[model samples]
Target: MSDKSDERKRAARDRLEQQRELDRARERRRRTLIVATAVVGVLALAAVVGLIAANAGKDDHDSQAGPVATPSGATGKDGLTLQVGADDAPSTLTVWEDFRCPVCAQFEDAFRDTIAELADSGQIKVDYHLATIIDGNLGGSGSLRAANAAACAQDAGEFAAYHDVLYRNQPAESDDSFADNSRLIELAGSVDGLDTPAFRNCVEDGTYDSWVEKSNTAFGEGGFQGTPTALLNGESIFPKKGDEEISVAHLKKWVAEANKGRKPATAGATPSP
Candidate 1:
């Protein structure tokens, strides 16, 4: 009887020890799972914090829907053509040119001063139509980009100065440097008050790209070919025959003759379509 009692007590103690061991194993697993979950959550939070810190210093404002509103009193088919001088002026000199067009650069350089002087003196109204034919021909975005930048400058009331500066600093026809937005901003700085934050955003975001496309289409639909096309009083005045390299003197004389022959002047003659 004593031996049986001792055996029963040993068996009961063994079963109790096995239960205690199982309880310990379960507790260890629960602790391990808790610790792993905590570690994973902390890592995920750290990654989010790092991402926020990285983009915090950037000025990535969402682009506006379209270009700044056209400057007041400017008239054209949706600002596709930039017109200067009194609308009543006797002669309307319409010019079709692309910023990246080599010949356009030459024409601008040669006749820039005369054109500006005449327009300022109320002798003629100059209409500048932007074109991107060079972009299509040369496979670069420079023509379109530069044209858009010019429109942005127009919004700042610095179109004339900016226009001259663009032609003055025009890159080689084969080079597409103007395609870079940074370079376009650099050019804007050439014209005072043209490199503002608004202008920068306009150029970077291509605010006037649609306008440029429309102007290019207008150039084609107007039955024009190539850049540097000149029209005086709605008549093609592109140098011809022996007048291939027309001089400023000849241009002034031609304007004088056209003015002399203009039927009684009206002060509010908008450019012919």
Candidate 2:
């Protein structure tokens, strides 16, 4: 009887021990899982932060921008469009751009010299229309202010110089640094005689704000897709999606080839009204 009792107690104690072992194993698994999950979350967060940091400074460098000014001596009509190249050129290149646009800056980088060459040589006439679609798209006033400031430069007859300067110093599309009017004035310093008091007051006063609005309206109504849109001889070269890929050399070749067979427009041909 005593042996039987002893055996019963031992069995109970053994079962309890087994249960405790099971509990301990489960606890270990829980802790390990928690640690692993925490580590994965930390890694994921770190990766996201790194990505954002890397791309924030997209195109614009920290240095003040400088533009290679190309003068076609075309037109500065309505304080909006600045025309360059010879009026009698057979090919007409019309461009719509914004100061805060990175892609437009890319186009400027690749084609500025080429455009200058064609316009200067009277191979093509280039018309530049400043648009503030970026301001509308990005929810900032930089586009408007920058366009106005460019217009201010027009009065000084340094539109080409300041235009180049603005693109040179254009901030990233996400950065609204161009919205600060002071920076606009500071950028004016890049152009000779463009940083004067009149230019300063003009930028501060937002003198051409109305014209910027008008230009934006024209851009919206012009049936265009996006910034850096270019039209050659009143034909769309930048169709929305699925259009042929475009590059600097492609553009230059397009112009050169087009000029070969282009018929010169009659004098007084619908002056950019």
Candidate 3:
């Protein structure tokens, strides 16, 4: 009987020792799993941070692209303005536009004829300022490319015609079709005498890319809200002027009022109004 009792105690002790070994093994596995998960979490965080830094660096590089090549006949501060009428006109119509902005296209469609007539009559001068806000917001280079192409057209002395053509053939805001130099060149065919080798070279080479970037930076620094920001004689007059909603008649009336006593721009006068 004593031998049997000792044997039973030994068997119980063996079972307890085996259970402790299993518990230790489970604890070791749990600790390893926790360490592996932490390592993976850190790696993922590092990857995200690296991606952000890389994108920010890319943006900085793009904003400061090589030397600026100002377009021919460009005027105003830093040669950023693309004037579309006699500079001596009594009233100056300042238009800040983005090629990829649908609202700007709409505004152009609505007021293109009236604005053209007013500009032609020497009653108002149009100062066009290009911006690339859409490209920054929508993750594409269409705005920059199109603006550069337009600057090329300005170099070719077909800025007015090409400007109208771009709006007429403007693609959907989401479509980055204008980013293609070939597409911009194809559009240039609509403007007579504007699709020459020199113009094509300018578009392909992005001669004014830095200039466009500078203009975009200025737009951001100007405290302006959005595209199609139209101002008349330094007063905001788009969609509404004071309490009156902007219309074709209202636009004409406003120009007439501004030019009440002022003489129309005489031929051969100094270009600066």
| TM-score (C-alpha) between model 2 and the true structure | 0.64
Q: lDDT tens digits, residues 141-182, model 1?
A: 999999888888878777778888888889999999999999
- Candidate 3 lDDT, 1-273, residue by residue in tens: 999999999999999999999999999999999999999999999999999999999999988865578998889999999988886788999999999899999999999999988888888889899999989888899999999999999887788789889998889999999999999999999999999999999999999998999999999999998998999998888879999899999999988988899998764222331
lDDT against the true structure, per candidate, is 0.82, 0.77, 0.90
Looking at model 1, which ten-residue stretch has the lowest summed lDDT?
264-273
State the TM-score for model 3: 0.74
Per-model TM values vs. the true structure? 0.68, 0.64, 0.74
Runs of candidate 1 exceeding 4 Å displacement: 1-74, 241-245, 261-273
Which candidate, 2 or 3, would have the higher TM-score against the true structure? 3
Off by over 4 Å in 3: 1-67, 268-273
Candidate 3 lDDT score relative to the true structure? 0.90
**110-181: candidate 2 lDDT, tens digit per residue:** 778877777766677778888888888889899988988887887777877788888888888999898999
Residue pairs with clashing backbones, model 3: none
In model 2, residue pairs whose N, Cα or C atoms come closer than 3 Å (at least 3 residues apart or on different chains), thus clashing, are 72-85
